[model samples]
Target chain A: MFPTPIQKRPVAAQALYQGLLPIALIMWLLPLIAVALFSIRPFSDFGAGNYWGWPSSFEMFHNYGQVFFNSDMPRYLWNSVLITVPTVVGAVALSCMTGFALGIYRFRGNLLIFFMFIAGNFVPFQILMVPVRDFTVSAGLYDTKLGLVLFHIAFQTGFCTLFMRNFIRALPYELIEAARVEGVSEWRIFWYVVLPLMRPATAALSVLIFTFIWNDYFWALVLTQGPNAQPVTAGITSFNSQFVAQYHLMSAGSIVAAIPPVAMFFLMQRHFIAGLTLGAVK
Target chain B: MSVTAPAVPHAPSERGWFQRNRMTLTPLLFLLPGVLFFAVYVVIPIFQSFQISLYEWDGLGEATYIGLGNYQELMTDRAFEVSIWNNVKWLVLYLLAIPAGLFIALFLNQTVVGIRLYKSLFFFPFVLSQVVVGLVFSWFYLPREGILNGVLAFFGLEPVNVLGDPTLATYGIIAAGLWPQTAYCMILYLTGLNAVDPEQIEAGRLDGAKGIRMLWYVVLPQLKPATFIAFVVTIIGALRSFDLISIMTNGGPFGSTRVLSFYMFEKALSEYGFRMGYGAAIAVVLFLIMLIFIGYFLWQMWQDEKEARR
Candidate 1:
């Protein structure tokens, strides 16, 4: 309502506002749009230096098929799935119990533990790079999907705990107090009472973590090596290196690597924003 | 699982010490798994990394403790100097995203038809990984075949190589980084706009305050939380700028674009040979730079916690 709505302005100004919306969007998304257009073009388009011109032929199916069938792209995509899903489940599940304890109970050292998670969540990833890699290597989990999954679960728990704790803290304390007075065991209280009410935070954190771990390149590069364990972000880079000058194919692979997170964003836009803007509006 | 209706002190005399101290023990039980993992993977490693910084070792060998040796070398290292300069540039320029995002959010904060779709389309860049953003931008800046050069050529000017220019490469990578970062800031601002108090705005309007003056005096204070969060994330993003540099320039054109994060990776992991201790030293420097912000954030959270307790 700030600055007044365009509808409240003159009719010509309203018309102008609507007309400029798409233009601004197109200009903002110019690079992504260009690649999206290139993804459907044939190899001849780039080889001939016909970069911005209309493609000589549409090769959408051919390019995407080449990415899917003629490469380790499928394997890398599978690796991404293997790494991300378990991290989401592990991080979310771990954070729930952690959040419940930190949020519901007032005990000695509670704030210290909660602050530890909050602080760890924001430190530079580089600080963890060498040690985490060494730790993973020593544990014999190096170059494996499980290595990446375990490291991600541990790293992501920091942020997830902060989110889940804040969410659980905001719930009415009376419900928890009433349940506690009935002498329900602590685990039963968490399982039946707190866990049921935590579904929204869980969904929000799950989608956010899925996108984050799916799109992760630093850890995928640091903790795992080769197509054996690398996620699509790193894999697609290697794929590009192999098929150099195949910008069309590269664009297609980029789109392929990007699809899952993009789809998740569209499908879960509200919850994703809720998770991201956890501290913004408040 | 039945709720205990008859509360006769739960027959406390019959319980063992474990059951008697359940209130104190239960929270720790719930916290054990998460705490163990966090302490092992996150907490312990921070100390380990700090310890490793004092020694000299290849990743696979015995560490020789030469206190302050690597830090002494860093005093005159030209690459370290450039990386630090570039980091400063990144930190300063990335702040542009906050103002730019606020501008865009104000532009799109309207009730036009199909506005939601427009907003999503604008936000689409943030969903893609920085690797993809880097690739798209590298191609976007290509001298002959890129859209940027194509546009210059269309204007009857010679094409300039952006990524290949030593002087411009750092700014070039920073621009690519700002693309997605701006989108992220815009989303935060949009959410902030939703929560701005309308009554204060009306009060300002009644007092003859309008537009920029009104925003400065009235609306800006309300957006403080959003601004604070946006600044924190932007600072962290600036310091953690590695993926795009890795994908786009690889610290190329004579290493003009190397930030601290990339330089640390190069020292620790790349084909440059794993000087693990030296890399740890660099990581330690980065960690110290980050500690300033981390300290501020923790202090703020502590104050908030105190307020909540009160």
Candidate 2:
């Protein structure tokens, strides 16, 4: 609206704008495009000094197979899914309840508690890192998917609760008041009346939590040590070390490590954008 | 009209003490699991780290209580100074995202064909993992054959070893970081620009305001919320910048690029004797630095909430 719409713009300016868009897009995505290109490039091409040239032969299929079959990539991916899925479900479900409580209740310390969750959400992870690792070890949950999942669920609850409470608070209170006046049980009122109405918030939160837990690198490093429990994010780091100068293989693994979250984003782009742009709009 | 319908009959027991008090208890019941987990994993650790900082341990055997020794050492440890300074540099450089994003937003705000696709394409960097960003940029900055060097060579200049030079390593990583952050800021500004008051723009135009004058006098003021969020997130991202530093240099070129987060990790986790206590002390310092921004942000949010309530 600010710049005149292209259809209404002068012809020369319009053509120039149209021409630059794709070029700009390519430059913007140059790194990812390079990675994709490098992943298919044969190892021979590297020593041959053909880094950016056309690939001598396409090894894309071989690279994918070797990454998935030979390396611990599949196992790492399973670890990611194992950690992320439960964190998403558990965090979202917990936040829904906690959000309802905080939003609807007229209790003392309500704002204080809400602000604590918000503040805790912003606290540096390093403060929690050492003691958390020690606690995980003592609990004998070290290097286990369960440990990562529990910690993620806890940490994510802070942000998810804040989002959910604000969302639920924005809903009409009359619905709950009507149910209460009819002597409906509080639990029933929440489940039968409120939850069904919270579908959009749930969807937004699920996609969000899924991506955050999946891409989490620091916690994965802290809790999991080996392929037995390491998620793809941390595994990629170790993989980089092993595949030093093996850019093709490393790039392929990076692609694999990125797929789940990328897939989630594309699949739920609307909700994902909605979740991220929450505070931006208002 | 729909409210005139007959009310559903209620069982007398529904008004009993249990039913009447259920509202008060149900919320607490709902809150328990999340609160318990949050307190155990997040809240308690802050205090635990504070306590751990008072001691000396390698995370095995017994921790020796050594009050202030780690802090004392940090006072003189050159690497600590280097990492802290790099973090400050990061914080300052990262602020470029706001203005960069706004300019890009202005450039791309036109309703051109495929503009939506363009926006998303520009936003792509934010989606990729920092590991991938670091890897790609490492290649991009790789001296002789790197893309940047190749471009420079085309212009008859010698290749610059951006990452190899201790002075430039932090800057190189900061540039990589800016690519994504600028994209994020662009998105926020795009959203803000969408909401800018058109009437105000027309009014300014009638008053002969144009270009930077119009933007500064009229448009930028309306973008306050977007700018605030961009500032806060960029600061947090800059302070937490560990992945890029780790993957790119590993605090290298003579330990010149260690940010606080990566430095703390090196102390705690690596086979570097697992100095958990010293690591905790470093973490506490980083946490306190972050708390400054967090406190200001919380105060701002409180003001916003109060205004909303009013």
Candidate 3:
């Protein structure tokens, strides 16, 4: 509106604006588009120097089939799901209680605790790397999916608590007061009153957390090893090494690794954006 | 009604201490699990890392008290200096995303046909993992078969190897990082723009402000929240740049692209020898730098909280 809507512009300017949109989008996504194009091409195309030309043969299924059936990609994908789902559930469940407490109750150390979560959420991962790995190793949870899941749930709680607490704060407080006056116990009040109202926040946090855990490379590298427990982000490197210089296959593999989160974003675009843009408007 | 009335009188007399004090107990009970987890994995480790940085250890043996020996060594390490300089560069240049995002947001702000689909498509890059972005850009910068070179050839200019050259490699990776970061900022601005007051825009028009003038004086002041968030995220993202450097260059072409995060990992974990003490020391430096921003952010939030309380 600030630029003056195109509807109010001259016909020539409107036409030009319409034409420019597609060009800008294409240019913006060109790098990703290149990878998509590369993924579907036959392996021979790279050898024949047909990189920019139309693919000599479409091997979309074959290349993707190799990733799914022939390699350890499926194993890695499964590891990612196994790791991500638990982390999402654990982080969300933990944050909901924390959010409820901080939002609903007046207590000593409330803001102090809240600020601790926020500050912890922003600290560099490096600072925690050595000690966390040390703790994990000592606990005999090293190189295990459970190890990754636990750490993720713990670390993600910081961000999730910040998000959930803020959201819960904005809820109507009278509902809880009414529930309390009805002689409902505190736990029941949370379960029956506050929990139901937090659905949108829960959905938003779940999708965001799912995508985050799935795309996590640093933790996966630190806590896990080999195809047995490594998530797809870390596993993609090994997948590439196994097929070094096979650009088509490597491209396909990386695409496959990227798809779960991409699909999650698309399906939950409303919630995802709602979660991400929570602070942008206000 | 009679049964409920009879039960009400008995309830308070039969109530235990837990029921009598549920108000105070409830929040603490609910807070226990999350607090425990956060303290163990996040809070305690921060202190532990500080402790580890002072001791010389190989991560497998007894650590000796060195008392800033690693920091002293860092003063003379060339790679550490390069990494610090690269970090400074990243912090400065990465801020370009904010303005670039605003530009894109303005360009796409209009309600043209199929605009919903266009907005999402424009935001596609941010959703992809940084590993994939790094891989995509690495190939895009390939000296021989890259589309960038192909474009240059089309324009009859010489093709340059972007990531292969030390001088350009860091910039190349930063550009790749910018692709997703810009998308993130654009989405934030788009959302912010949606909530802008129309009355103000119309008032600006009546006052002879148009285009850039309207944007600078009228629109931007309203977009402060979005800008603050953008600045916070961009600064944090710049400092936390590890995955791209790892995936694209691996601190490559003679370690030209290493930032503190990557260098810390290399020192602590990589095959370059597990100097856990040195790595922790590097992390401590990065942590101290981040603390400055963290302190400022918390102070701002504290002020906001006070205002809300008032």
Candidate 4:
């Protein structure tokens, strides 16, 4: 209702606004548009420098097939899945506890611990780079999906805890007090009372964590170097090196790597937005 | 899951530690797994990096201690200085997202048909990974054949080799980074706009305030939470910039696009003989810079907590 609506604006302004909207969007998405177009173009057409022109043929299926068959795309995808799934479960489960503790209870070192988690979450992963890698190697977990999973679980716990705590803190205290007065055990209160009320928060956190782990490039690169344990993000990098100017195949591979997160985002659109904008609007 | 003792209320002081702090202790049990992982993975490693900075080792060999030598090397390393300076530029230029986001939020805060689709399409770039974004931008910035170059040729200008040109390459990568970053900022601002009180806008309009003046004097003040969050995330994103730079340039054209994160990766890994110590030093410096801002944010949160308690 605000901004007087486009219909209520001057006719000239409305016309100008409509015209500019598409132009602005096109300009903004120019790069993505180019690559998406290129992905369907035949290699011959691409090699012939007909990038901006209409594609000579639709080779998207062929290009994508080649990425799947020739490269370690499946293995990489499996590795990503192996790492991300456990990380989501570990991070969410861990944060449920941490968030509950920090949110519901008052104790010594409460603020100190909360601040530490927050501060730790914001630090660059590079600081943890050497030590984490060494620890991974020493545990003989290097070049294994389990290695990446362990590190991710640990790292994500920081952000998850912060988010979870804020969410749990915002929950009404009266419900908790009422449960306590009824002689319901603390664990039962959490499981039956608080847990059900936390559905939205849980959904939001799950979607966000899923995307975060799926798209993680830094740790994937740091922890694993080969396709044996490499994730899609790092796999895309290696594929980039091998393909070298094979734009169609690279584009196809890029699209493949991007699909899971994009799908997750679309599927959980509400929760994704809710999670992302948690503190923003409030 | 234990039976409760019959209600026999006693003096609060006489309660055992377990009873006295039962609520807090119970939660800590839940916190143990998370706190332990956080400490091992995030907290301790930071100090570990600082310690690693003092040693010289190719991860496989014994680490030889060389106190402050890496810092000395960093002092004279032109590549280090240039990368650090580029990071400064990235931090500053990347901040344009905040205002740009607000502008877009205002533009889209209308009850128009197909506007929801428009917003989603605007948000498309953010849902994809940075690797995809990098590849897309690489194609766009390619000489002669790239869409950007095609547009340039239409205007009678020769093709510019953006990625190949050392001077322009960093800017090219930064631009790519900005695409998603700006979308993220816009989403934040949109949420902020949604929460803006209608009555306040009505009051402002009745007072004859309009356009930029209305925004600056009224709307923005109400959008403080969104702005604060946007600022925090954007600054952190800028500092932790690695993916786009790695994919697009690989610190290329003589490492012109090297930010600290990528540079640290190159130093510790890649074909650079794994100077983990030196890499850790670079990381430590970046962490120290981030720590300053993190400290300020925590202080503000603490103040808010104090006020809430009162």
Candidate 5:
């Protein structure tokens, strides 16, 4: 609206605007498009120096089949799903209680506790790297999916609490007060009253956290070792090493590693954007 | 007496301590699991890392206490200096994503046909893992097989090896990082723009403000929240720039692309042998730098809380 809508413009200008949209999008996504193009090409195309040319033959099914059946990709994918689902559930459930307490109750140390979560959330992961790893190893949970999941659930709680608390703060307070006056216990107020109203926030946070844990590379690298526990982000590196410069297979493998989160985003775009832009609108 | 006895049983004095103290106890009860987890995994480790930084340890055996030894060594380490300078460069250059995002947001703000689909497509990059983005860009910068070289040949210009050259490698990785970052900022601005006050824009238009002037005076003032968020995320993202660097360059072509985050990983982990103490020291430095921003952000939030309370 600020730019003066194209509908109000001259025919020539409108035509020019429409034509420019596709070009700009193409330029913006060129790198990804290139990878996508590479994914469908046969391995022979790279050897023949047909890098950007039309694929001599399309090997989409064969290349993807090889990635799924021949490699450790499926195991890594399963590992990612295993790690991500529990983290989402744990982080969300924990944050819901924390959010309810901070949003509904007036208590000493509330702001201090909330600020601690925020500051912890912002600290660099490197600061936590050595100590967290040492802690994990000492607890005898090292190099296991459970180790990664527990650490993720704990770390993600900081961000999730920030989000959930803010969201619960914006809810109508009278509903809570009414419940309290009716002799409903505090726990019941949270379960029956506050929890149902937090569905949108829960959905938004869940989608966001799922994508986050799924795409996590740093923790997956530090806490886990081999395909037995590593997520797809780290696994793709080994997948590439196994294939080396077979660009077609490597391209296909990378794309496959990236699909779950992308699909999550598309399916839950509204919630994803809502979660991300929670503080953007004041 | 019997009527008084039934009334007494229903009185506050007869309630259990748990019921009487439920108001205070409920919050503490709900907070227990989250607080415990956060303490173990996040809070306590922070203090532990600080303690570890003072000792010289190989992560496997006994640690020796050498007072500030790692920090003293860091003063003379050339790789550390390069990493610091590159971090400065990253902090400054990564900010370009904000304005670039605003520009793209403005370009796509119109309600053209299929605009929703277009918007989603434009935002697709941000959803991809940085690993994928790094891999995609690395191939895109390949000296021989890269389309960038192909494009240069099409224009009859010489092809340059972007990731292979030390001078250009850092910039190449930053550019890759900016791709997703810009998309993130664009979405934030788009959402902000959706909520802008139309009446004020009309008022500005009536006053003869047009285009850039209109944007500067009218639109941008309304987009402050989005801008602040963009600034926060971009700063944090710049500091946390490990994934792209690790995947794309691995601090290679002469270690030209290492930032503090990546360097810290290399020292403490990797096949470089585990110098846990030294790595913790590097992390401490990075933590101190981040603390400045963290302090400022918390202060702002505190001020906002006060205003809301008022």
Candidate 6:
């Protein structure tokens, strides 16, 4: 509105604006388009030095089939599901309680504890790297999905708590007060009143956390070494190293690795944006 | 609407003794699992990491307290120096995303057809995993056949080796990083722009404020929250830039692109050697750098909390 919408501008300028939009988008997505194009091509295309040229034949099914059928991609995908689902559930469940407590209560050390969670959320994952891995190893959870799930759940609780607290704070105080005045127990008030109202925030958080844990590579690399426990994010990179010169195959795997989060974003676009743009609007 | 008693000490239950102290205990009960998990994994580890930095250990044996030896070595370690410098460069250059994102947001803020799809497509990079991003860019920077080089060749120019040269490799990876970061910042700004006050903008317009002057005197001030969040995320992104470097260069061409996080991993976990103490020391430095920002973030939040209370 501030810039003056192009429709109000001269006819020529409006036409020019419309013309430039698609071109800009295409140029912006060139790398991705190239990857998609490459994903469908045969490895022979790479060998023939026809990298920029049209593929002689499209092998989309064969290439993608091999990625699924021949590789540990399925197991890695399974590991991602195994790790991410529990993390989303754990982080969301924990944050709901913490968020309810922090948002509703004004006791001493409340802000301090909230700030602790906020601070920990912002801290680099490196600080926890050596000790967490060592801790995981000592606990005999090393190279296991449970180790990754526990670590992610804890780390993600920081962000999710921040989100859930702000959301819970925004809810109507009277409803909660009404429940309390009815002589309902505190836990019951939270259970029946607050939890039912928090469905939207919980949904938003679960989708966001699911994407985060699914795309997490650094922790996957640190905790898990092999296909047995490694998620697709790390496994894709290792797959890159393992299958050198198989750019076609690697591109297929890249697309496969990217699917879940992409689907999550597309499916939960509004909630995803809501979670991310938490502080930007107000 | 506090669970705490407002006027009288209202006792709900007489059957269970827990009702007598429910006010003090209820919140704690709710906070227990989250607090316990966060304490063990995130909070206590800070102190443990600091302690680990003082000891010499390869993680399998006894950790002898060498007391600042790793930090001492860091002072002279050239890779450490390069990593720190590159991190500084990453921090500085990454700030470009703020202005770049604002520019894009301003361009696309208009009511256009398919604008939603356009915004989504522009934001597509952010949704992809960094590993995929790294792979895409590595291929994009391919010397002969990559699209960037292909474009250069089409223009009758020699293809530049982007990721191969040690000096340019860090910058190359940073460029790849910017593609998604700029998109992220743009989304933040677009959201901010949506909430801007039309009355204030009209007032500025009536005063003959236009273009850069209008943006500077009016819009930019209104955009402080978005800018603050953008700064926080970009700084953290720059520091946490391990995936790109690892995927693209792997600190290659004589180890030119090692940020502290990636360097910490190389020291502690890589086949290079398991210098856990040295890694912890590096992590401590990174942590300290982050503490400065974290302190400021907390201070800002604290001020807001005070304002809310008031």
Top candidate, metric DockQ: 5
**TM-score, cand. 2 vs. native:** 0.95
TM-score per model (chain B): 0.94, 0.94, 0.95, 0.93, 0.96, 0.95
Highest TM-score: give the candidate number.
5
CA lDDT, every model vs. true structure: 0.90, 0.87, 0.94, 0.86, 0.94, 0.90
Q: Candidate 1 vs candidate 6: which has greater DockQ? A: 6
Given candidate 2, what's the lDDT at residue A93?
93
The digit string of per-residue lDDT tens for model 4 on A107-168 reads: 88998999898888889889999999999999999889999998888888888888888898
TM-score of chain A of each: 0.98, 0.98, 0.98, 0.96, 0.99, 0.97
Q: What is the TM-score of each candidate against the true structure?
A: 0.97, 0.95, 0.97, 0.95, 0.98, 0.97
Of the candidates numbered 4 and 5, which has the greater TM-score value? 5
Which residue ranges in model 6 land beyond 4 Å of their true spot? B1-15
For each candidate, report its DockQ versus the true two-chain complex. Answer: 0.77, 0.59, 0.80, 0.77, 0.83, 0.80
Report the lDDT tens digits of candidate 6 across residue range A210-252. 9889988899999999999999999887777667778888888
Q: Give candidate 4's TM-score.
A: 0.95
Report the poorest 10 consecutive residues by lDDT, candidate 3 chain A: A26-35
List residue ranges in candidate 3 displaced over 4 A: B1-14
Could you give the CAPRI-style class of model 2? medium
Per-residue error for A253 in candidate 5, Å, reads: 0.3
Candidate 5 residue lDDT tens string, A1-282: 677888999999999999999999999988888899999999888889999999999999999999999999999999999999999999999999999999889999999999999999999999999999999999999989999999999999999999999999999999999998999989899999999999999999999999889989999999999989999999999999999999899999999999999999999999999999888887
- Mind giving the per-residue lDDT tens digits that candidate 2 earns over B1-310? 4656348754564467766577678888889999999999999999999999999988888999988999999999999999999999999999999999998888889875667767777876777778778888887887754667766777999889999999899999999999989998998898889998899988988998877888898988888888998998899999889888888898899999998999999999886669999999999999999999999999998888788676
Give the 10-residue window scoring lowest on summed lDDT in candidate 6 chain A.
A237-246
Candidate 4: give the TM-score of chain A.
0.96
Q: What is the lDDT of residue A273 in candidate 6?
A: 88
* Residue pairs that clash (backbone atoms under 3 angstroms), model 5: none
B157-231, model 6: which lDDT tens digit per residue?
988999999989999999999999999999999999999899999999899999999888888888999999999
Of models 1 and 2, which has the larger lDDT?
A: 1
Give the count of colliding residue pairs in each prediction. 0, 0, 0, 0, 0, 0
The alpha-carbon lDDT assigned to residue B305 of candidate 6 equals 76
